[model samples]
Every structure is written in structure tokens, then in C-alpha cells.
Target: MPEIPNEQKKAKMPKSVPFIIGNEAAERFSFYAIRAIMPTFLVAQFFNPAHNPALQSIAEARANELSHLFVFFAYFMPLVGGIVADWFFGKYKVILYVSILYAIGNLVLSLSTHDLSLFSTGLIVIAIAAGGIKSCVSANVGDQFDKSNLELMSKVYGWFYFSINSGSVLSTLLIPIIYKKYGPELAFGIPGILMCLATLIFWLGRHRYVKVPPTGVKKENFMRISLYALKKAFLYAWKKVFFNRQDKTVWETVAEKYSPEAIDGVQAVYRILAVFAFTPIFWALWDQNLSEWVLQATKLDLHIFGYEFLPEQIQTFNPLFLISLIPVFTYGLFPLIEKTGIKVTPLRKIGAGLFLTILSFIIIAFLQEKIDQGGRPTVWWQILAYFILAGAEVLVSITCLEYAYTQSPKSMKSTMTALYLLGISLGNIFTSLVNNSIANNGFFARYTGASYFWLFISILSGFFLLYLLVAKRLPEKSYVE
Candidate 1:
């Protein structure tokens, strides 16, 4: 092939980029709008509102459990969606179809407000729909560029994350006001409309995308090759234990029909998964901005400068801070650090984020202690904590988005993205289990008030030290070209 001109390479942004970013913005708005209101909405709709502090506290705790559990299911569905896209259909089809389901899920939530069972059913549908398309949409962005413009992938992913937080900031601020003013139906209905718009925007990009065809049960598929390798290893172990004999080494036992590329992709998947193992701890601390943080806001003095802030609206600070911080980190902080003769790797960023998370939770723990002592401290304390948390999110989440794409093999891109998302699901499960245990007066029930935040702080501190050791040893790779 002839060498591509430098000037041509400079104009590397794909036409389909706008469509993907627009769809992501609208879709994120729809998702965050619903999520922003879910906890308070659940407590208001189902539990006692008669000013009984004991019942109200119990109700709020249950709301936290239910909310986190819903998030657990939402994040878990990406695995199924990734498998379907990589093996049966392509990314575009999966995104298009699942987006329609997403719209329906929102509609169901809008109409089912009065009935808990119906609302729970709506949540389940939304979880499957939203999580299903997530991995495909992200992987599809990387698919748009090849070796000619692969350097632009990181910049595009940054913009993609910016679009997500843009939607989040708008929804987090607006949805609470809408819910308070109009009621659940209209509040929920607006998000459903936006989801439909997101679907339409994505569908308009169909012909522009460079759609990768599915592997479709091929023997050379990454999963097939990995499974064969595992089977060979098992038989080799069995023979050694009983017959006292050995066959070929494990790596040498992969099926011959599979190409070297397929085997390499399987190996890449394992490495990516190892890095993903430490992410759940980060997410477990981060996602509380949706539930526990908002709940904590209610105990604070929400009035700031003659304006009363809604508890749910306080969650807006995260995305708002993200909108500003992403650019600062991408354009300023990272470059400044690079100029200081220090290398900034993804694992390093993530490890630093773990430390920041511990700090944020310590602040939260202090604030919770004040609340328990009947001192309604200003909301600014939490906002200060949000500032720190937002910085950590910039380091961890955006870096992971770029890392997961670049490290993945072409054939398993969506699957690798799904595996990364599985970490979020696992984190939410951890949060849910903690909440459940507390609700049942189990072992965790002993940790109350400020101690709750301290518990996470301690857990994350240990993980932060361990993640440093892991990052030191973990190798980095890139396959964007």
C-alpha cells in the first residue's frame, strides 16, 4: 500500500463521529434523568411520608438497597449484549435494536409509577436494554478508525466521555425539578422521549459506520479458541494425576485450526480481565453518588446563598465538575505532568484515583459524623468532596474507556468492553450486598452513621496499596492500529 499523506492523516475525524456522540449525549440524558430521581422517587412513592423519622429512615435505607440492586442488573446485561454482537449480529444492529428496547423500558417506567411491581418490571427491562447496547456503542467508536487515523481514537473517546457527562449534568439538574413540579409521569415521560431521539440519531449513522461482521460460531472465534485451550489443559492435568504422564504444554495445546491471531486475541482477553479485577473497588465507592451521597445530602443544610437546593439535585455536581475537569485533565494536567519527566500510564492514573477515592470518603465520613451529632453542616462539604471525587472519576473512568479500546484485539473488542463493564456490575453487587446485610441486621449492621463511610474508606485504602503493586507489574499493550 502507498504511504498515506501526513495532511490527509491530520483530517482523521470520521463523519459518523457526530452521530455517535449525539446519540450518546441523548441516551445518557435519558438514563441519568431516571437514575437521578430513582432513590427519592422510590422513597416518596412506596414508603411512609408521615414525618415518622424511624419509618422514614428505614424506607430510605430500603430505597438505597433497591436502587443499587437495579444498577447491578443494569450493568450486568452488557455481557449478554456483547456476546450477541460479537457472535451473532454486528454492533450497529445490536445498538439499534437495544435502543428501541431502551425507549420501551422508559415508557414502562413512566406509566407504572403507582404500582411497585410494575415499576420493578420496568426497571428490569431498562436494565437489560441500557446495559445491552453499552459495550457495542463504545466499541463501535473505535471501529470507525484504522491505522491511518488510529491516533485520534483517544481524543474521540475523551469527547465521547464529555458527551456522556454533558447529558448527565443536564439531567441531574433538570430531572429533580421536573419530578417536583410535574410529578412522576411527565418527569419519566421526558426521558423516554429523549431515548427515542437517541435511537433515531444513531440509526441515521447506519450507512456511515464501518460495520465489522460477526464471527458467527466460527472455530477461529476468540472464545472457541480459549475454551479449547482450557479443555486441553484440563486433560493434561488429569493424565498427569492418574496415569503419571504429560502431554504438550498448555500454550502448545490450542487447536491447530485456529489462526495465530485468534489465539493471541484470547491471550489479550485474559490480560485485559486481570486489569479489570481491581476496578470494582473504585466503582463501589463511586456509584454511591447516586444513592448514599444523595441520601446524605438530605441530612445537610441544602440552602446555599439564599437558594434551597434539592437533595437529588446535589448529584448534579459530579457531572458538572466532570464537564470542566475532563478538559483540564486531557489538555492541561496530563501534559503538565508529562513535561515533568514522569510517565502517566492508565494504571497509574487509576491507582491515583483509588487514593483520591479514599480521601473523598474520609471527608464524607467526617460529614456523616456531624450529621449523626445533629449538626446539619453546609452542603458545601459534600460539594468539596465531590470536587475530589470528580477528579478521581476523570482519572479512572475516562482512562479505562480509552484503555479498554486500545488494549483489546479486533475480534474481541466488544467482548472486552463488556468485560470492563462487568466490573461496574460487580461493584454495584457489592454495594447491594452491604446494604442488604445492614437491612437484615447482619454483620454490617453494626456499622452505622459515620462508621458506614469509614468502612468503605478502610476497604479502599487497602485496595489502593494493592492496586499500586498490581500496576507496577501489569504490562501495557495497544492494538488500535
Candidate 2:
């Protein structure tokens, strides 16, 4: 087969690219618009009527918990979503169906602005729709190319990243101002409209896309392979414990009908999951921008040069920083690191991100200490935290998508994406646990928020050091599809 020349790669982007990119930008905007103002909105909507001090305290804490839980469910739904797409619906149909739910969710939020119960119901629906398609959209972008035009994929994914950040930045900046000035109805309604637009754009590209049909429940499903791997692992361990040496032909003993490619894919899945295990903790730290950090900002002075910034608006910096830094790191910083003879593998990049996370928390610890001391610090302190944390996100989140797509077996690509997103869900669970523990024990973050952040710094630092030590030894496994 003749190689496609580099010049041709840029000259002809597939016809479907614009529709996908447009849908992503609109969908992201709709999601972020709601997310940006949720904490402030919750506190405003729920806490204002509480007359009793005890009820007020409960209201305040519940606000944070609800926000965290919403994000938790949003990330968690991808499991069911991914499964349906991989097994029955296919990515295109799943995305189309879910996008309608996404629009209705936004509509409910807007119409139910005054009633918290209705609003919460809308959020639940949105969580299902948004999270369901979350894994499919990027995976759909990957399905658009094969070896003939595969060279364009790298460039395609770069713009995909840009689309995510662009929508995020737009909504993060837009929604807060709209909420403050125009009221909740308009703030929520606009995103509802955008969700409809997202759906429309996705539908427009139906024929242009390179659609992947659902494989249904094959014999070599993830669960079976995982169980097989688990059994093999136990047998190997048993041999090591009793007989001294392990079985060398463990692979051969499995069902011979399973191709080498399938076995290799299963092994790769296990390895990929093991490497990605630490990411939930990473997201746990990152998701705080929407909850705890923003809550902290709400309590402090946000004034700068005769203007004040809302806590919700502070999230705008994440996408702004990402937009600027993703390219810089992609082109300038990563190349420089490679030039210095340091191997910058994906896992190592993730390890570096962990270290950067520690640094950001260290900054948070210091900032929280200032808040504890009754000295209202400038928003710059938290902005500094956002800056460093966004850098870590650039390193980790972008790399994870590439890692998940490339490392997965074709049959299990959506499954891999869901597993990747499940990390964020688990991270949200971790946050909920930490908060619940504090409620019970009254030791962690009871007196000073500084201590809570300091503890996170130590946790990440230990993990970062350990990951760097072990990452180099990870097997570079692959298969012929």
C-alpha cells in the first residue's frame, strides 16, 4: 500500500469533522454553563430561607455534598452508557438519543429554577445524558479514520481538545455574569438552547460519519477476559507459593479459539487499567475547583482593581489556561523534555502531573491557612492554584484520552473510554468519603481547611514518587487487529 503523503493529510479533513467539533463545543458549553454556577446557585436558592442556625449549617454542608454528588453521578453514568454503545446502540445512535435527553434536562433546569426539587430532577436527567455520551463523542472522532487517512487523527484530536476548552471557557465566563444579572431562568435557558443546537449539529452529520456498529455481547467481552485474567493470575500466584516456578504457558492453556490478538488485548486492558488507577485521585483534586475551592472563594474577598469576580467565574481560568498551555506543552515543553534525554512516556507525564498536583495543593494549604487566620487573601492566591492545577490537567487529561484510545482493543474501545471516565467517578466518591469522614470524626478539616489540603499534598507526593519508580517497567504490549 502506498503511503499517504504528509501534504495530503492537511489538505482534506473529512467532511464530518466540523459537525463533530460543533456539537462538542455546544455540548461542553451547555454542561459548563450549568456547572459553573451550581454551587453558588444551590447556596443561594437553598440557604436563604433557613432561619435556624442548625438548619443553616446543614444547608451549607449539603450544598457542597450535592454538588459533589451531581458530578459523581455525571461521571458514573458513563459505565452504563459505554456498555449500551458497545453492546447494542453503536456510538452514533447512542449520542443522538442521549443528546435529546441532554436537551430536555437543560429545559427542566430552566423551567424549575424556583423549585429545588424540580431542578434537582433536571440535573439527574442531564447527568445521565451528558455522562452517557461523554465517552462516545471522542471515540466517534477516532472512528472517523482508518489507516488510509489515519495520519489526520493526531491533528483531529488536537482540535477536539481545543473544542472542549473553547466551550468550557465560553460558558464559564458567560453563565456567571448571566446568572448574576439576568437571573437563573435566562442563565439556564440559554444552555438548554445550546444543548438543542448540539443535538441538531450531531444529527446533521449522521451520513458523513464513519459509524461503528455495536458488537453486542461477544464471548470475549471485558468481564470474561477479566475473569480469565484473574483466574490465570491466581494460578500463577499459587504456583509461585507452592511449587517454586510459575506456569510458562498460561496463555496457551486458555481457550485456543481465542486469537492471540484477543489475549494480548486482554493483557493490555489489565495493564492499562493498572496504570490508570491513580487518576481518580488526580481528578479528586481537580474537581475541587467546582466545589470546595469555589466555596472558599465565596467566603473571601474577590475584589480586583475596582471589580469583583464571582466564585463561579473563577473556573474560567481552567479552560483559558488549558487553551494556551495544551499547544505549548504539545509543541515546546514536551519536545524540550525529550531533548534533555528524559523519556516522556504517557505514564511519566501522568506522574509529573501528580507532582504538580501536590504543588498546587501545597499552595492551597498555604492559602487556606491565610483564610483561617482571618486575613482575606486576594483571589490571586486561588488563581495561582488554578494555574498550576490546570497545567497538571493539561498533562494528564489530554494524555488519558490518547492513552485510552490507542491502548484499547477495537472491540473494547468504548469500554476503555468508560473505564477511563470511571476514574473521575471514583475520584468524586473519594471526595464524598473524605467529607463524610470529617463529619463523623471531626478531626479532618474540622478546625482549619489548611490541614485537609496539606494531607492531600502528602498523599499525592507519596504516589508521584512511587509511580515514577515503577512506570518505566510497564510492558509495551500491542496486537495485530
Candidate 3:
């Protein structure tokens, strides 16, 4: 390992830190630029002539469904990207190469705005590229620090997240302006420029990064272990639930061979799997902030200084709120808790975050009730929801990142990051399912719009809380960093 000079060690982070920061900043700008406007753009820019005209009742519904489908696949592609990065290209090279694809995806999106088929293809490509880069960049951040500087890693993550939000703030604020003033062309084109810049910035830091070579055995071992554990756990749980109940003799024999202590390790694996299961519900809510939520905002009364706001501008609140809250929670809230001798574990924070998510939707559901009661809701209601949701994000998202990195086998770090991303991907898929249910069912159907939508989320979140409580008692020491 390379030793840092004493003088340099005590100083602020090196040029590589800023380089990584800059890369992340630009990458986020690109992502949010397209994401902020995607829902609206789907309705306006990529309307299918066969499905009536854009914004017509039927067309609007179809467009929303299609937009969600795009979102689902965009998230799903990270699994493929993570696999490629872990098995073939190293994280650095994979990020660099996929970034180019990212840039191209944006360019294609810009050019294909009016052509539905081409536009959809462009969006798919962009999702693949985005998914590819998402894990790589995050894992790269972990690569920047090691055992000695690991204490500073939290601060580094804070800064990285800060850059992400700063870039998101800019993109959210500007992309809408560009769409309103210039058109979709400029709106999408600017992100391409930023993405190219991000790629260049990452490349510049190549030599400074902690370049861990791919361990050929690790990937194979992970697959074998994960599969074997999953299979055994399912069989054991099944036997306990069914066969053991009917035959006491069989139960005792099985218990003797695979005692509770023997199966504790399998339970731990199941617990981790359980975490992945319920986590997508949260993502369903998170990803929709840019899509369904923006659409809802358009229907609400929004004003600032007597000027009505654009829907896309409302998307800015998430990142803006994140940027402001990060320091407050990290510096102020964390220290206050520490001073009081209250230990804050990631799992506890995640549970609290999950509960907070329930509150966020409850707020939205309440606002929808007001709207349904013939009173137009205030935009401030949406703002409040964003504030609560942002808090949940800080608790769940940040903790998940740190937890995933720490809990992963050292050789499988990038794969773990990909797994975390997969949780979000699955969340989007859940969102799609929800969206599809709403669309296919009548607007007045039991599960349409806010009433049905929020009720479902509340149930899912409640289930997640229950699972967390049950899994909470499992020993986590095996995976702790």
C-alpha cells in the first residue's frame, strides 16, 4: 500500500477527490436533467399517434404507463452493468466506457424526441448506461479510501452526496427552463455535455485511484454461495413449516442434523434477502418523485411570489432539500445523539426511515383527500412531503450505501454496490406494477389515484417494518466491517 506523506495526510483531500466530485456532479446533472422532465416529455414529446393525441384522456394515460415502463427498465439495467464491471472490465474502465454510452444515449434522446420508437430506444440505452455507471461511480468512491483514511470516508461520502444534490439542483432548476424556453433539444443536449465532462474528470483521476484487480475466483464463489444458501434456506424453512408439523419424528431428526444454531447462518442469509425484498417499496416512492409526483404537482395550485411554478421546477426540491439536510443531520443531529449516548445503527436508521416513508405518503394521501373534497391543495403540502421524504432518504439511502459497502466481502464490493442499486431497480418495477394497476383499473376504481395508491404503499411499508423488527434480532457481526 502507498503511504501518504505526513504533511499531505493532514491536509484536505487531494486533486483526485475533486476530480471524483466533479465527475459525480456532472453525472448527476445529466441524470436529473432528463429525469426531471421525462414524465412530461413522455406525454408531450413521444405521443403515439395510434393512441389518440397527446394529453387527450386516453393518450395521457398511455403515456404515463409507458413512461413508467421506461423508468423500470432504466433501473433494471444496472444488474447487467454490475455483472459486466465485476466480471470483465474493472470499475474504472467500465465507468469510462459506459459513460460514453451515456453521452450517446442523451444525444440520441435529443435527436429522437419526436419519433416514439427511436425515443424509446434512446431512453433504454440511456438507462443501461446510467445503471452501468451508477454502481461503478459509487464503488469507486469506496476505492478512494482504505483502512487508514476510512474514518474520513464518511465525510467523503457526505461530500459526494452533496455534489450529487448540487448537480441535481442545477439540473432540476435548469432543465425545466430549457424545456420551457428553448425546447427538448436543448434540455436533453445540455446533459450530454455535462456527462462528457464527467467522463473526462473521472479519466483524469485514473492513476490516483486504489486500483484493485478483479479476483477471478470471487465472482464464481459469490454465485455458488448465494445460490446454495438460498436453496438450503428455502428447503429448511419449507420443511419446518410443512413436513416437520405433520411428523414429530421427522422434525426431531431434522432438528438434530440442522439445529437452530446450525441454521442461524442460513437465517442470516434470509434476513439479508428479506432486506432486498421490502426495500423496493421505498424505491417505488423515491423514483416517482420525479414522475408521478411531478404530474400530481401540475394538477395542484403552485405559486411563488405570484408566479405559477412549472412542474419540473418542483422536482428541484428533493435535491435542494437533500443538500441542506445532509449537514444538519450529520453535524448537528448525529452529535446530539452521540452526546446522549444513543447509538445509531444503520438497521435502526433504516427502520426509522421506512416508517418516515409511511408518514410521507400519509401526508400526500391527506392532501389528495383535500383535493378530492373540492378544495385545491396548497403547493406547500407537496413541499412538506418532500421535506419528510428527504429525511427518510438521508436515513435509508445513506445508511444503505455505507451498510452495503461494509457488509460486502472485500472482493465483492462492486457487486454489493450493484445489489444496492438492484434494490432501487426492483422498487421501480414495483412502481410500474402499481402504475399499471391504476391505469388498467378505472379512475374511480378502489385502487386508483391517491386513495388506492397511498393505501397500498402504507401496507407495503408496514410489512417492511414488521420484517425489519423480526430480522433485527439476527446477529449482524458476521458482516460488519
> Which pairs clash in the backbone of model 3?
none
- Cα TM-score of candidate 2: 0.86
Which candidate gets the maximum TM-score versus the true structure? Answer: 1
Q: If ranked by lDDT, best first, what sequence of candidates would result?
A: 1, 2, 3
Rate residue 126 of model 3 by lDDT.
82
Off by over 4 Å in 1: 1-21, 140-161, 201-213, 255-257, 335-341, 476-481
Assess the local accuracy of residue 367 in candidate 3 as a C-alpha lDDT between 0 and 100: 78
lDDT winner, 1 or 2: 1
Candidate 2 local lDDT, residue 385: 86
lDDT of 3 by residue, 1-481 (tens): 8997664666345446888889999998898788888887776655533535332333444455666666676666777766677667777888888888988888888898788888888888888788777766777787777655667788888899889888888888888988999988888888888988988888888888776555443423445554655565667678878877433343344444454443343334444555656577788777777776777776689897698889889878887788788889899987899799988887777887888788878887787777657677878888998998899999888887777655544544555556677778777776666555555665423554566557657676777767677756744544563
Candidate 1, 1-481: lDDT as tens digits: 9998776766568889999999999999999998999888888888655657766656666777888888888899989888888779989899999999999988899999998888888888888898888878888998999887888899999899889988998998998999999999999999999999999999998889999998786667666677788888899899999999887777777745567788878888888777888889889989998898998998899998999999989988887787789889989999999999999989889888888888888999999999989899999999999999999998988788778879977777766767778899999889888877877778888666788889889888888888877777887679987
- Which consecutive 10 residues in model 3 have the weakest lDDT in total? 51-60
Candidate 2: where are CA atoms >4 Å away? 1-13, 47-60, 145-156, 231-250, 255-257, 405-414, 437-448, 478-481
TM-score of each: 0.88, 0.86, 0.80
